[model samples]
Target: MPFTVYEHGAVAGWDVARPLRPGRSAGISLAGFRYRSAGSADLPVIPHPAVTVVVEFGDGSLVMGDASGWQQRGSLVAGLVPGAVRVRGENVTCVEVHVSPVVAHAVLGICPAELDRTVVALDDLWGRDAARLREQLGDAPSWEDRFTLTDALFSHRRGTGPPADPEVVRAWDRIIVSRGSVRVEDLAAEVGWSRRRLWSRFRSQVGLPPKRATTLVRFRHAAHRLTAGDSTARVAAECGYADQSHLHRETLAFTGVTPAALAADPGLAVDDIAWASTAPTETA
Candidate 1:
């Protein structure tokens, strides 16, 4: 697939590129980014509902640090809801992949729960294969080629890796379709599984239990809406929050910032362009 490059002056000096076509799997999405000038950047890593994989190339360096002062550099993977982490780098260039937790287990070759909401070196997970991938991406002639290579790698992994349970996938899809408003009991009934069984399987396979997953999904939606300049009160009501205070509490808990600050965050400002069609939409 070809890439559509944009000079994104609005978002922290990033030159972004997204695939003309979506990845082969609905569970995976990719975007490429390059810094226009050689300089350092420290941007907050906002929590999202997917596992994030970043493959860094070029002469620049990429480092991810958490609130606890734990840090990892170079190509890395951050699990779902990686809390209070920041990405720092100089002239960074990389292909960022967001793998839906439903299929992250198969594509990443490990249970998402094992990631434990922390950033880790990709080499720690993929071993030497991670280094080879960075080399391949760097050697690629264009952003389009880089995206193609990434899609191929994930396609192969998902094909050969063990699959998440069918019931788990269904439940996750329903939560997404409902924009995280679906209750655990409803999901269990729809999937024909006991509540306890669903909770255990979901936590083990998707990394977060059903309730936590719902919170993440809902928070993700609310964050994007806030980023789009929605009013806190309206967003709260439309997104299933009890009130503006409820929205404020969840936003603060997830991002460590109030709704207004989160709305102005640079990390989320680029989502409309980079994620475009893949971001979930409200279901009727």
Candidate 2:
């Protein structure tokens, strides 16, 4: 895989790599990051629409924290809408996997609802397997090899794990395809489920209720547009918000930052390189 070196602004001195080929499973994406210098790095984590898994190796000093000053170190899993979090580390090297909620349960071996917008140690969910994966990745000779290992592990887990409900998957697909503009009633009708049933099932299976999920998807789309340097007014109008104020409220609720601030976020600035092939409304 080719690596893109970012030596300015937020991700200075970092080598970010993406897989040369696509992963075997749908809704799964991988990005590899290796910080060259031994100096510390601290960057905010913008909320996204996927389950984020960071498998760290070098120095094992990566730390993730939230607004309340709570922190966790080493490899970790952050579920959908993990609000106001930041990652800080020294000499960090990791393979970060973003799994769509539609398939996250199967790949992560736990329902996203269990994660519930919190960051937890990978070992808490994957036990010794997480540590072993870190060791294997650390020993890998190259980023491509590490990406291969990571993809293979997710594919294997997804194949053996229990699949999500077809109805839930359909609803999630609708949300993504419609850019979260689809109504819950319409999704329920399409799936031949009642709104109440779809709500319950979607929440249980996909972690967030349909309404919240819709907002997340929509917010993600608007966020990318903003990061691309689009004006707030244009982004709001194009992305289905009623107006700029609506966009502002949603952005503030999700990220605790105004649209202007989020537009300049270092975390989002690397999206084009790390997640180029993914849709703005899809996984991180």
What stretches of model 2 exceed 4 Å from their correct place?
1-11, 278-284
lDDT of 2 by residue, 1-284 (tens): 23333221225556677776788989998888777766787777877789999999855479998778899998999989888778889888888899999898888888899888788889988888888888888777777678889888888788445788999999999999988899999999999999999999999988999999999999988988998899999999999999999999999888778999988876677654577654222112
Distance from true position, residue 33, model 2, in Å?
1.3
Question: Residue 23 error for model 2, in Å?
Answer: 1.3
Model 1 residue pairs with clashes: none
lDDT tens digits by residue: candidate 1, 1-284: 23334332236677767775667877898988876665787777878788999999878888898677788999988889888778889979899999988888788887789887777788888887788788888788777678889998888777445788999999999988888999999999999999999999999889999999899889888888888889999899999999999999998888788999888878777655567655422111
Could you tell me how far off, in angstroms, the CA of residue 194 lies in candidate 1 after the best superposition?
Answer: 1.3
Evaluate model 2: give its lDDT.
Answer: 0.83
> Pairing residues by index, what is the TM-score of model 2?
0.91
Global lDDT for candidate 1?
A: 0.82
lDDT value, residue 205 of candidate 1 = 88
